[model samples]
Target: MSYAPSTAAGKQTAQQLADISRTLYERGWMPGTSGNISLRLPDDPGRALITASGRDKGELTAGDVVEVDALTGLASPPGQDRPSAETAIHAAVYRVTGARAVIHVHSPYATVVAHRATATDAVTSVRVERFELLKGLGLNDPTSTDLPVFPNWPEVDRIADDVAGHLAACREGPPGLLLGDHGITTWGDSLGQAKNRLECLEALCRLLVLSQSELHVSRA
Candidate 1:
């Protein structure tokens, strides 16, 4: 839960997160300070650097990150800036998947699909099959897979609990999960790989939305 005072704040890793944050913000996926990103320390996977809460993603600097204990999601070596409220979700992903980086964003299409697919108290899922972008998700069977969508609970730690349970049960799951009425969270071996997976999943969601629109028009 807590770590000893770390002398270094992982400035290099924070800078990398800041760079990715700016890029995602420019793409309109991380508008305002609506999303968070985290990267595990290369030498110490138990601890990670997450973007500081309430900071504009577009304007983040290397100092804009808080190092946290991955297992407990607490700011270790506590700093003035707090970690994002959704740090629990990132921690769950790392704990369950052994991913080195995690990215959460409010990209519109993914958000739309998540809302559309969510119709029950229990978590719902949308499946994409035979899409070329499926390769980007690193699934063993690229032709088909289901993306789980969880309700946007007011308490974020509850959502993280669901994520950890789902991922642990489905070892070969897709690279990402969607939070209904919220956004998408993705993870991978590296930040760049995670970013690429986000792009691929967002595009797939866009295509799914467009196809549904076409179906409605045809029925009309």
Candidate 2:
């Protein structure tokens, strides 16, 4: 697929993306360059400025940003370069929610929860209950919710389709979706909002992991 360069607004969003990517990477949430971020142009919702593949997100620049077809997640104008492989999932989030920015992170805690959710037939979702960070996700303060989880598919589009289906059924939760053995996808109406949601969700996941570990220890 091909990609076009970003517009002026997208350039600013691109810079913010680079900044957040580095922060997340430093936190070990995006190790191995395993995360991706994108934002809808301020003037166009159908086109998105996405990170280019294989770039060290720690040092991303405006030049590393490219525009992609928001509906299909393919690079715009047809070219040799490609966006992140998970770009399709970002497209799905925008299509289903009308979001202007999206982020996917391969966070250790979230990845662990995702894998454990799908590693068995017992549960397919994780619960976020009575956590202070729950408020950060726009949920009721101290309320409980489910984080929808799905098993990973070799084909990214197939996973996107599944996420779209789940989203069509339920609009609540953490405002994000987790892929088994993969990571989390979150979005917002703006790049900063999207970044904040990703950060909050990752923190929530970390809390869950720690609490669960303590539970296991107590049980033992």
Candidate 3:
């Protein structure tokens, strides 16, 4: 699972991916092998360097990186171990959105909020307004942004399709979505940006939950 060598672009190298995973794990966004991250190879846009499946993200190392084709969903360099089971969802996202990196996490806030929305078919879209942190999302004008939430499905193909459809309908900046009762999926132009977006999303979800609870207590 160790990378052969560092590449020129500095994006596809194994160490970079490992570092990003460890950072996310420390932030508590990924716990108990509950997340995956991938960055597109800078030289070969058609390939991605991703974290291997079921590894403890907190202890991720260079040996945990694997290369896979972005188009065919096949691991490259032949004989390498399989990427994460959710690789299909990642590949589908890259194909539809042209994002350079994807981060999926089962953070507590996102999981709770998603679970609350599980009873319905319509996406639970969250709109964050009047919060200075909203600026972190990089929306076109920063007025307000609707973050779409999709229903969770066991099949990757179905989940990918719903995600793709939501992104297409929204047609806005750096689209990210949540899977009901599952987790959050976010992307950006690079690994850093993607990580930043995930952080913002998780924080916003926490704030939303807290605000609602406070309102309920005040009313009672």
Candidate 4:
């Protein structure tokens, strides 16, 4: 799919997004075409810069970013390679949280926890608490927040609505979200903060997995 040319500033922002995408991809957070990243234009609050559809996260280019109407989720210079299929979900997150940037990736830890939680047939959300990494989320303590995980929906719009509702209902939780057997979505006031929060969540998940290991040994 082809994407329309972005404005000078948009191109710059797109480069930044592309850079972050590559970094995250190298870190194994967003592999293949399994993740999306977006940010609101610095000057215009209603326009968002999002990754074009199906582009490899590891080799993202400025052209891989498309400008879309924040509220309507429509591409600016309309064409193929339309914004990520999950653009609506990112838009919903921005509108609901007043955040300027959002990152959604399918990492192993988040996917496993989300899937594990789903298998229990209990609640749809996953909680990570009492870890020192909690401070990475800018929290005073672990009890202050939980990651909200929602079941993936075939209809993207419905998933977006559910995310919006969850954000509304839980004002204290971290900005990270998980789609069961899908991936994790996180955002913040800026691109840096958004990426930071993503790293924090990923690190927390890794620690959680490690903490569960009880290696038995006998003194030699």
Candidate whose lDDT is highest: 1
Best by the TM-score measure = 1
Please give, for residues 1-220, the per-residue lDDT of candidate 1 as tens digits. 2122244546578778989999999999999989999999877889898988898999988878888888779887744577899999999999899999999999999998887876446677787777799999999989978898887888989989988998998887799998988899999999999999999999999988988753111000
Q: What would you estimate as the lDDT of candidate 2? A: 0.75
lDDT of 3 by residue, 1-220 (tens): 4556456663335777889888878878788788888888888879888888888999988778778987556788877766888887788788878888998988888777777655345556655566676788888867767666676777777777776666666677445777778888888888888888888888877887888753111000
| Per-residue lDDT of 72 in model 2 | 80
Q: Looking at candidate 1, what is the lDDT of residue 169?
A: 89
Ranking by TM-score: 1, 4, 2, 3
How far residue 118's Cα lies from its native spot in candidate 3, in Å, is 3.1
Q: Relative to the true structure, how large is the alpha-carbon lDDT of every model?
A: 0.86, 0.75, 0.76, 0.78
In model 1, the Cα lDDT at residue 27 comes to 97
Residues 75-177 of candidate 2 have per-residue lDDT tens digits of: 7766546788888888888888888888888888878777766632222567677777878787654487788887688888988887777777677656787
- Tens-digit lDDT string for candidate 4 (43-153): 787888899888899999877888888766777665556689999999889877888999999888877766655522222655566667788786656654567667677
TM-score of 2: 0.87
Clashes of 3: 0
TM-scores of the models, in the order given? 0.92, 0.87, 0.87, 0.88
**Lowest-scoring 10 consecutive residues by lDDT in candidate 2?**
211-220
lDDT of 1: 0.86
The ten-residue window of minimal lDDT in model 4 covers: 211-220
Q: Over 4 Å off in model 4, which ranges?
A: 1-6, 119-123, 140-144, 213-220
TM-score of structure candidate 4: 0.88
